[model samples]
Target: MQFFAPLVALVYLVAGAESACTGPNARTTPPPGAIVVDATGAYRGSFKTVSEGVAKLSTATGDSTLFLMPGIYKEKVTVPPLKGKLIVQGYTCDTTSYSANQVTITRAMAQNDIPASITKNRNDYTTTLLLKSSNVKVYNLNVANTAGNVGQAIAMKIDGANYGIYACKLTGYQDTLYANQGPALFAKSYINGAVDFIFGCTRRLGLSHATLVDFQKWHKVFFCTRKCFAQMLKQMKHILVTSVTQT
Candidate 1:
């Protein structure tokens, strides 16, 4: 849970990202070799579904970028191991922060959905977005598992190396983000969960200038970070915590 200032600054580039989204679900045509997933089919060379776009790029050999239009995409997305880097961009009104993020990836599945016969950790099976490709970068997106506060439901699971998440929001009730392994950098983002929202045995995690929402109300509950975790507030960037009681 350590926040690296230099790494956070270097990972996110906000020079001209505001132009990425001109209107709701409106995006320019992606250049050659690039993939754009639009909910309204507003952009040329765009796939109507996120799964279709990701499936097509998972087999390619070179670098590619996936642009997601502003919409509530109710689907599970998995980026498999690929040869080149894959960049996913969520359309936002303002690219410099998360206040204007309109793209959301949501799924409703919990540990209860799995059979008890399986002897593995139930959290792994509740992930909505699974990232297994190296050198993957995601920006200004919101991922959520709407399985209520009943059980473990992971919003995003990162199993890739050299992954960077910028200005994104991850939400769930329990086991929100399972940073299984590899070094990951999450900057200017928001993560919310009730129990063990951030867990796993990762080598290193750099969470800088991010807001962590604690939906469960309990006094003096400090979560665990397997190998190492650090809290940092560089330039007076606070880890905004909001405590909510769920009935």
Candidate 2:
């Protein structure tokens, strides 16, 4: 059964290739009032890093948006608690899928990177993108933890509720996505990992038209929903493959 899981998932992916998210369409320019981030310094007055743009929103009172220009951001980003809704949009040519995503936020951090003395959840420390705010929506970005074959490297860790992750790609080797708490929705996204990548304790989670590929040998545990009381809605069109040839 485990050997056939990947094939089953691939069939789902092929069947749902035309499905699209209900979120906003892809845009070439930043939306009005959005904070622009251009790593190449091409956009005048734009922040050079995602963290810098997020930092600017530390004291924001109303809805905020961060528009990341096309580039690879080699830094970890943390979205702190915000007073209102937040949207992080990345440059993409196609809005329907993550295949044409032009922006990638990557880091190579793992659980071993943290100091031994820290007693807090080390999983939070290994994430490339950490969300600590509610009412957050992320779109069209490739978020990766390049800590290859390392123990417990997280691509994205959501500690807040009401998150909507759309049209993005999340890649890692272990524990790729840590949905610590959620009433969250992941739509039109691709999540790739090897072991227990989608583990979470979220109460209500939805995977709509998404594909999850675990490209390593089958482990005893996959999707570790620990004491979660979860309402996991794996839509009929969603894909969950146990293995794939890593390129």
Candidate 3:
């Protein structure tokens, strides 16, 4: 009886350790009614790509959430205009920061890759994640464009209002994050690039505990804007702005 008691205690301890890693915000599992995306094929009946998961949301009514499993998804995702709010979250054991993020959406597309005659703005065409929907939130995923230091390549282009980007990493070589239109909040995230990395025309942008890094000689952190208002929290390091053209 005494030997069996130790085994019972060990089982409970193992169970407790597993439960400790899960929480409301931890996001180890998908939320109720969330569209699940698993690129690794481990989850049956789940969408195989991020794009497919987002496409499901286009026809979905009310607020929708897309939860991605832990894997590197090599694809570009675009969030089209929707009536309700949209949440795109990656699997993580710690939601408070992006360090524990297990999912990444990566693609390589440059401005020159798209034909100039097709669109007036080539920046919109080169983005890895293009958001055209309002009231959207992205959390705990690394969004990157691996287009190298060749011309203009965008990691993300957000043309949405009332959006929140939390605990994620956005990286590229040039023209990384295009905050084209926004009354948006970027919190606890990392943005890295070189040459007009965080360019935008956002009217109001809030940066709270976010890190921005530029790695090139021509270090122009920000570019064009129309009456831009930036709220930098105390935790934010200096924002090196060499040029800001008001339009």
Q: Which candidate has the top score in lDDT?
A: 2
> 1-247 in candidate 3: lDDT tens per residue?
9879999999999999778778766887888889999987788668999999988895546999999999998898889999999999899988888788889999999977888687776777788999999999999989999997888999988897898999998988788988888877888888888778888757567777777776754336767643342332322344432322322
What digit string (tens of lDDT, one per residue) describes model 2 on residues 64-121?
Answer: 9999999999998989999899999898757778898989999999878889998797
Model 3 residue pairs with clashes = none
All candidates' lDDT scores? 0.77, 0.83, 0.82
Q: Could you tell which candidate, 1 or 2, scores higher by TM-score?
A: 2
RMSD (Cα, Å) for all candidates, in order, is 11.6, 11.3, 5.9
Best model number under TM-score: 2
Candidates ranked by TM-score, best first? 2, 3, 1
Write one digit per residue (lDDT tens) for candidate 1, span 1-247.
2478766665564534545556554333354667788899878777888888898785657788998887899998888898988888887766667777878999999988889997775666788999988889998899999998778788999988998899999988888888887678888898888887877757466777778778775321234542244431222245566787755
TM-score of each: 0.79, 0.83, 0.83
TM-score of 1: 0.79
In candidate 1 the C-alpha lDDT for residue 76 amounts to: 84
**lDDT at 73 for candidate 3?**
89
- Which candidate model has the greater TM-score, 1 or 3? 3
lDDT sort, best first: 2, 3, 1
lDDT of 3 at 12: 99
* Pairs clashing within candidate 1: 1-229, 1-230, 2-230
Q: What would the TM-score be for candidate 3 when compared with the true structure? A: 0.83
